[model samples]
Target: MKTTAIGYSENLPAAHPEALLSREVPVPEPGPRDLLVEVEAVSVNPVDVKLRAGAPADGFRVLGFDAAGTVRAVGAEATLFAPGDEVFYAGSIGRPGTNQRLHLVDERIVGRKPTALSFADAAALPLTAITAWEALFDRLRLEEDSAGTLLVIGATGGVGSVMLQLAEALLPDVAVIATASDDARAARMRELGAEHVVNHREDLVAQVLEIAPEGVDRLFTAHSEGQIERYAEIVRPFGHVVAIDDGPRDVSPLKGRSISWHWELMFTRPLLETPDMIEQHRLLDAVADLVDRGRIRSTAATVLGPISPAALREAHELVERGRTVGKVVVHGWEEAIDSARESTDIY
Candidate 1:
């Protein structure tokens, strides 16, 4: 087996946009209940870019969220994954991540890969899918399976893109009203199963009313700040709104509608070492089922080359630019190949 893995490195904060390097490091070992994944593909998120641009003064911070890979090994206590399962997951924010050739992830947070999708497409789903799933199901506290209109704030982003599909898969009869600032994005939202496409650049209230007229029952905000106050105005009395983005502003606007506001961070359970961290595993597995059954489609729109500092930096730049419509993935690494070879030998 290989002794080291390849990954991107950020040594210091960048005042401008040039402070990432690619290098090799020792391959990580799996702890109890963890799986050593041979990453086949990976995707970047906004958190990756922000953390890198404003990185803390430390050794280095490995930044990556979504990944699809084969399991190379399993910790003693790990029951779900073995040596050769194809899996996908949005690993913990508390540890070194999938930017490298091999990554150690808690088995409870990982899931079987969808047989229908390729590694790149599967890579796009994990982070965004988990974020969307938790926001709609966990934080919002919607029924395990129910139907109602769900308003998505930023439908073109990685999270919003997958969220739309999950909503559609879970509740096929429900109306999905998505907000996209432009025509291209609106089309993309529709492709993902949004019944109505509204413009966030205009009055959300007026635009939403034109479709439903009554009001939305649930609202999910995917982009950052400024729209909380607006969402508060449009949601029906006692409706729920869940936000994954951060803002320090007062949340008092929700008081008027008696609306419920939720903050969703996919990393919460893993980061805090919560008791129910395994729920992520369950949800991810459920997502895999939906994908394999052809109920939810992967939202990976673009595929880049092999994982490297330059490619990773470019991926981060795409997120920062706000023009990307769906998730982008990078594949090709020794870890994935080794895992495949081991699987063949065992078979």
Candidate 2:
């Protein structure tokens, strides 16, 4: 049952050698409806950095969400996938993460990997795509007939990048006003299908208002920290606002206009084992269809080389800095990663 994994027993800085330690850990026995997979690639998210820096661990807590891999075995009750099937998933927060060479995930929450993409590329889509899809369709209730301005507050990160494409592909008639800080990011927003690109550094209200005179119908914020006030101002009366970050959300400022605030966490279904837990599998398959049909693309902008302690630490550093352009990923469990950094590297 032993397998290769990288984890952190202590909350240390990414530069520290012990931030992520490689070790042989006991791989859990597959529960019924579980698929045991050999991980091929993984992408880093902000959740990984937050837990690594703050969440205390007993021995070593493996922290990863997005993974693309092939099924090695299936539990007795698992019928959705079989051995050798390529799949991608954002694992349940209740279980051990996908950072290890072998991982166990419920088949209901896993989807077939997009045949058009490599493992690393497919790995980047699950978490972000699921978040965006849930935010737009489930929380915000953006339907095909729903028409109004959709303003994306932070439109350059992994979630924002995929959100724009989903909005464009799903709601073709809806105008999208995306916010970015710099010229390069603004250009990227346009390329990804934002009808109007504004600068987040400047006055978001004024810039967004110029595009939509009344106000944006809905707002999706990837970072929800200090942006709630801005959300109250830019969003239209009786409009909807959906956010994905975790923090204080005092919506007193939004009550005047009756602007409803909603929160989205992609892990909710799998974490609670909800009746609709299989929705993730369906949506991921839909996203895979979109990818194959050339309607959308992966948000993996940076690949850190391999699945090792050194590469994961570097990826965490980039994510913690809060400036990663898109999802950061590491592919392949090659031996070179172990010998790359003398004291810091772990396989």
Candidate 3:
């Protein structure tokens, strides 16, 4: 029951990262429908930082959700994965999580990693990709034939990047619009297949109006509450707007346009113990196939450190700043050293 883990003992925000540190703890065993993963790589998300600082100063809180690794053990009821299989998952919000050498994850929420990507790159995709995928395909109900002006707000960040690519690959006929204020970031969005890129700093409605000359059919918001309603202006009547952030705000204005509002929390199924938790497994498998087929590439923007608490805290800080262009990953020390050894002499 003993294992090596990384977590925080005190409550601290990303800005004050010393609060998170590595610790040795008891390893968790897989329960029915769970798999014990020997974690190879993990990624940091803004939620990790928020929960760390916001949560009560209880015992150690393990906060990572995105991970790639090998299965070391499987619960009696687990049939999807077996020992020695390479897997990746965005673990449930309710679980102890993947910021450790070993973790217990529901087998139904995991999938095989893309054989093409590195553990670090693969680690970066799960949480954000799943969030974007479910929001567009599941919540918005965007069909393969759902062609329209699709606008992605905050489109250069991790989730946005993957969402842009997913839209491009699956909905090829749909015109994609992305918001990015910076020149470099806007160019990146275009490279990822956004048909148009606009400045989030300026008037979003005007820019979108100019581009569409009509109205947007779908809007995916990753930024402010103000932006969500602003997007409502650009969406055609009865168009859909989906957001992953569930901050309290008024959506009254959207009602006038009959614009449907949706909230996507990739963790909802696992957190609520939904009967559809297995859907995450299916979605992840689908994404892995896309990755393998080169329809989507890893959006790993940075690699922080081997799985040390100090490194994770730093990664959280970077994410909190709202500046990282893509995903950030950290490897277990063994995997980190091994990666260095195997890489070409490029550094």
Highest-scoring model, lDDT:
2
User: Whose TM-score is higher: candidate 1's or candidate 3's?
Assistant: 3
The TM-score leader among the candidates is 2
- Candidate 2 residues 1-347, lDDT tens each? 69998889999998898899998988878899999999999999988988898998777888898999999999999998999999999998888899999999999999999999999999999999999999999998888877888988788988889999998889988899898999999999999999999988888788887888788899888777877787777888999988888745477888999998899999999999999999999999999999999989999889977799999999998888888888899998876456556547453
Candidate 3, lDDT over the whole model: 0.86
Question: Residue 252 of candidate 2: its Cα lDDT?
Answer: 85
Q: lDDT per prediction? A: 0.80, 0.90, 0.86
Clash count list over all predictions: 0, 0, 1
Residue 52, candidate 3: how far off, in angstroms? 1.1
Residue-level error in angstroms, candidate 3, position 195: 0.7
Each candidate's root-mean-square deviation in Å? 4.0, 3.8, 2.9
Worst 10 residues of 2 by lDDT: 338-347
The digit string of per-residue lDDT tens for model 1 on 149-214 reads 889887888888888888777777678999888898788788888999998888878999778676
